[model samples]
Target: MESLVGLVVCSLLLAVQGLYSPSDDVVELNASNFNREVMQSDSLWLIEFYAPWCGHCQRLTPDWKKAATALKGVVKVGAVDADQHKSLGGQYGIRGFPTIKIFGANKNKPEDYQGGRTSQAIVEAALSGVRSLVKDRMAGKTGGSDHGWQSGGGGSGSKKDVVELTDDNFDQLVLDGEEVWLVEFFAPWCGHCKNLEPEWAAAATDIREQTKGKVRLGAVDATVHQGLSSRYGVRGFPTIKIFRKGEEPEDYSGGRSRSDIVSRALDLYSDNSPPPELLEIISEDTLKKTCEDYQLCIIAVLPHILDTGAAGRNGYLEVMMKMAEKYKKKMWGWLWTEAGAQMELESALGIGGFGYPAMAAINARKMKFALLKGSFSETGIHEFLRDLSMGRGSTATVGGGALPKIYTVQPWDGKDGELPTEDDIDLSDVELDDLERDEL
Candidate 1:
């Protein structure tokens, strides 16, 4: 009887362990300790908002554990059952099952993980995030004064990205400039302004890097530049305003965290940027120039004009154009070639056997390429690119380990294809009847 009781106890322990034990690599996060463990900590975190009953989340369990183990020392991996912790999931706007977010330098703003669901992809993305954080630190784009803002008037050499606006140049820089500006009217003596100085400066640097100077952050001394402050109706200690070229200055009403400010600035940048142009691969120069200029070139080989007439071809082009706009921030080059137009190019990219509307993403510098195996729709393309970006997709070395020779070809005429005219054959010279008689 004692032996049977012992066996029952062991079975119970095993069942409990299957649920979640201390040996589990992934930290189980909940409302009780989430803020203290993740938000307040400086370490990078990859958190998954999952539902306990979700099949997809269950399937991802082993891979998530493996990733957590691999990133043991580098990145912290955690999971929260969003179904049980509805408030926490709702806080981050988690609407789907197994949604992952990376909490890096700015814990207040966790970025959505659009990478593959596999362990390798998770590890690559986490390491990439760590590298970015380290780079920013080395560049002095982070950190703040432990004690309040320094007394050095206006701007510092480290905060060069944060432009100093004066009453004299305010109109010229903020109102007249074509770029989107986030201006802060602050008094040097105000404690709140002092506290916001470092956050604002850090945000400015990140915004400048991401937007390529299309969006700017500036500050003004409300006490010294009273006229400028009064003009914008600055009544508070540190009032922030958004200034566009022609639109009236609007109040900046977002969170004060660095991530919040940077996120808002990026949105403004995207709104200002025009949709990326889709070019046709007309010659060697066209292919070389476009591919070399961007990190990745998305090349598509659509069906021949005879197969899919002008209307069908245009429909495919529209899909590409929409995807180009969606991922315009990646700065990838988009080009399309008619089927059988560039034989060498197709051979190098291994796109011949693939029916029509085939796509391949090439990294020219690395001489690597990943072919699209899914449908040529928006969803399929988005998943393919997202996996490639996170280093999850399988890639092959470019044929000949270099770009193939591209034959110069005429551009598509946007019209249906026509068969070449054949010359008439005059066989009336009696060859058929005479040959039959001779053979008989």
Candidate 2:
């Protein structure tokens, strides 16, 4: 039994994004490869389960293709068009045009993208969501099943081939020989699906060079891959999944942009993804503005360098920070700052005059903060954060904790050659009454 358990664990590890056999390097997933394709995948998998009879899904065919091409290697990609297999579609609980679902390598429940049903948008959604899911799960957490938004897409089809992911060849799609596969699972009628059409196409074109062989992208219609979808537990549209060689899948949540989708695929260099922590970087302008206004106590510390022009400044800053923390309720609050270890030495007193290696205890706009320079140890970072949270040395802290801004863009009209109205409509030409071209 223990041996069996280990085997199961091993299997799960080997299947982050499942492998696939790309025959022509053109298109490999088809009705014939349905069952074997999905099941053999030991890693992450994004299967588009759809049906041909559904007018909406039929129209979204091209969008699916574009998604496939854009997210080739970072994940396993495949499609299971349901028309060819009626029972398969029903089993997957696909009661609509297109449905995208993702499977983690542990191979338990799959996350679903239940937004709008454009081929491009849905494919992108499924790939994006599944990647997050698989990544989170591998880290011992479930992210995809937690939260995500909806989307819209176009109601037309392009000259792209779409596949249906079915139970029969589901594993084959991932295990046949491809390194990574990112699949699109979507529904056609979803308004958001329609909106995502152009973005999907644009993504494919942009990443054409980056994805090539390392990635194999594809799609599926939830309306088709009944058993496969059911087994994976897809509950929505526009879901995404990433399949890798020897790890369980990393299914991501959120229906986002084409660039984001490409980023997931390229996280492995060349195509490359923005570093995970990059999202938390503070903008230089934002920082500068804050520094100028706040007379609050601020301390900047260097990681390695000492006994230089910056050294005195660093020590003074550190003392100042402690003093401020001690007198927080007494009108002496300080902000903390820190810099990377690689930064140059600082001044002995007053201003370090050193632009780099300045970090720890920063104050501005009533915000008392702590920063680390040069990738300080996680232990040190955590310790500082905990200290700040408790107002550690300070007797009291001003109450005010705001949630991080996690914005989402909603559905909109996406016609060819038409730009995003929100950003394009110029309020500069204000006529108010009879709108006419300004005769300037």
Candidate 3:
């Protein structure tokens, strides 16, 4: 039994190792030797960027090794463990696992390999790249220009979004600043740093536009600012770190694509923003201000105090508050009014026909509104808002194609409603005995 268990463990270990290690013909590339082994070589190269934890990368291991062995002397085949060496992978903008690139005569600008994952398909693509390189050489074109991939300052025409950081300004701009920053420490002469320049710049522009400068991107020249580099423990060509006020700097391990960086920046922005306030619609100004200030305004017409009382009404408000927190990233407005409090607003939104506890989403800019047909629970409201956000819900133009006339009203007093008392009539002066005598 002991021998059997040992054998099974050894087999499992072998299987795991096979996913990361290819055949001898395939060269293992890392941050230290990638530039020397592939970039400076005259031979055509095919490299795969992959993560060991990815199932797809493991499935492609056998075919990759076979193709490498077949093209041993003709073309160079290499693979990089992108998860382990993130700086190298970020330089190349490796967004997904099992991504392959073809490096031809123009080593700086590599073309993405879109062929099949089989050995035959990979070999054919590599051969085609080799033929194209030979033809270019025969035509006296070296194809070594750096303009193919590098763009000047985010491709935004002179207005750069990425800030330049130095030792003198790093503390003031990043550590003490009120905004979030994703800073890259890089050297000018490094090949990997050059590759990451365009991606970094583009991401900076997108993040700035999305967050309105609440989150920023910056870069520091590690070779020039040794003090800052050493402080951040920057030993690589391009190391990205996230900095927020009163927080410890953390390494950025996400993909280097523009979308990846933008996604992370937006998440940070949402975390820093407070949730939308749930306001009571007490006056015309309250209704107008909340609706016009946001892209979408969600209004809930809660049940009358006589019907739901304080506890039931509070339950409904709690649901709305949770929904508001869930979609706070959308930056929408949340408002509520008691039933019959705003008759004009209800008529314009067509809310009374559906009874109390109804909801509607209004787009003030477009003058359109969509009513919720689902229950008032959390799951129901979530589905309703999700569909509306995706443009799946039916919408109608607001009545008269404009905001309805709002009326000023007193706010809810947070108590059960009471019936008005009737005045007692003084009928004691009437003579009931005289009427009885007349009848007799």
lDDT of 1: 0.81
RMSD of 1: 12.6
* True lDDT of residue 184, candidate 3: 85
Q: Give candidate 2's TM-score.
A: 0.26
Top model by TM-score, which number?
A: 1
Error at 60, model 2, angstroms: 41
Cα lDDT of candidate 3 equals 0.81
* lDDT tens digits, residue span 1-440, model 2: 12354345434433333122343121334433533455335555666666543445546556656566666665565666554443344334454556776655433245675665554665567566666766777898632221111122322222131223445666886646445766666666666554554444434433444445465545555666656556556677666676665666657653345445555545532322221110111333333433443333334443322333454444544444444443333232233333332122112111233344343544443333333323333344445545544434222111242212222222112212223367567777676553554543
lDDT of 1 by residue, 1-440 (tens): 12354345434423332223469889998766776688668899999998654568879888999999999988999998776665466456676788999988766457899999999999999999999989989998763233123355543423777888998898898888889999988888889887687668767777786778999999888888889878888999789999989999889998775656776787788777987789999899989988887778999999999999999999999999999998887778999999999988899988877689899999896677888988999999999888776545556668899999988888888888888899998778868878799999
Stretches > 4 Å off in candidate 2:
1-169, 269-440
* TM values, all candidates: 0.56, 0.26, 0.55
For model 3, residues 80-161, the per-residue Cα lDDT tens digits are 8886666556556676788999988766567899999999999999988889888999999787643212233223321267
Please report how far candidate 2 places residue 421 from its true position, in Å: 80
